[model samples]
Target: MNVNIITIDGPSGSGKGTLAARLAAHYQYHLLDSGAIYRLLGLSLSEHGLLEQLNDDIAKCVAIAEQLPIVFKSTEQGVVVLLNGIDVSAKIRTEEVGEYASKVAAIPELREAVLQRQRDFAQAPGLIADGRDMATIVFPEAQVKIYLTASAESRAARRVKQLQGMGLDVRISDILANIQARDKRDMERTVAPLKPAEDAYFIDSSDIGIDEVFNLMTSHIDAKLANN
Candidate 1:
């Protein structure tokens, strides 16, 4: 069997990013982190001091996505996202950047610009893609599509802890509300709203360890290969 494409799609904080990187390492595959593209757009806008005018210059956002110089920097901890020659892994992690990413990602032109860039990462051995729309839009024909998700509360709690781990103090209640609001916005948006692809395999990681989630995903990958 030579199945070589794996897509992990989900909302933020569902452990999909960690699982996707693990799967890439396990299969020696190229990894495409699509969310980073949106983050890059947000960071690029911020760099120009034009973050406040993003809504007025939607075309500029698409242009940036159409030509993003974002790259993955391997660090001891995990992948650090770099934009336009600057290591902005920390700046992009803030709640403000996340919110801007959500809005920028909703633009139809921006999505189109980044679509092929995401697909071009797929290669011979395999490709593990992590993003909200990977299975649905970017790689609908992926051999194995995993929609990893968790309860809203669980996701928010994990995000809060993650922020605190980075030395940022935040309100758990605010994070929870933000998560719920994002869920609604992402699902109800006019463009490619976030939802599990029709043929995607769903997994809830509300109470599982990251390694355990990886095992479950790889077990399904093995089965998918057998089917292929």
Candidate 2:
């Protein structure tokens, strides 16, 4: 059997990450959380000494992405993201980093630099990749392609709950506005704009349980494999 390449693409707070992780665990496939890579890059350049001009900035961004030193430490608590020996899992979760990540993610040069690196994650065991562009751009030929989605309001509500669980004081309205803004920016970006691939299976998880999503995906995966 050929190694399975599973791509789960979705917007923020669409529960794609958790669903992808569970699928990876179920199949013992290597999981690639591609969004985290861009987040880490954004955090790395947060306090840069000087901003390069637009012409030269792309090269700089590409260089940084090409040499990004990221490590995923699986502790009992969960996955810990480390950059340059610093535990930045929490630091990279803030809104500031997220916005910056969106910016860097839209950079064509930066995307070109890390595109191959993301694809290299597919290997013997199998692979489940999660990101906005995983299905559309990174792994267009993925055997199993899923485009998960939720209402913007639902997504913001989920984010609010997530932040509150993290002991954060956040306003729902603010999150809603941010979500809309991000959606607009992401959909309008020139490079690798967010969209479902033609062959992707669309899923709405706003009212569905994670287990249900997983079961549905796994069954589809089995069918796809059998046909293959």
Backbone Cα, N, C clashes tallied per candidate: 0, 0
Candidate 1 residue pairs in clash (backbone atoms < 3 Å): none
What would the TM-scores of all predictions be? 0.93, 0.93
Please give the TM-score that candidate 1 achieves against the real structure.
0.93
lDDT of 1 at 67: 83
Question: Model 1: number of clashes?
Answer: 0
What is the Å distance of residue 13 in model 2 from its true position?
A: 0.5
Best by lDDT: 2
lDDT string, candidate 1, 1-228, tens digits: 343888998888888878888788788788888887787786677777656776687787667778889788766687888777888887887788888778778777777888888888888778899999888888888999999999999999999999999888999999999888888888888887899998888999999888888888889999998888
After superposition, which runs of candidate 2 have C-alpha atoms over 4 Å from their true positions? 49-56
Collision pairs in model 2: none
Task: Mark the regions of model 1 whose C-alpha exceeds 4 Å error after superposition.
Answer: 1-3, 49-55
Error of 2 at 172 (Å): 0.4
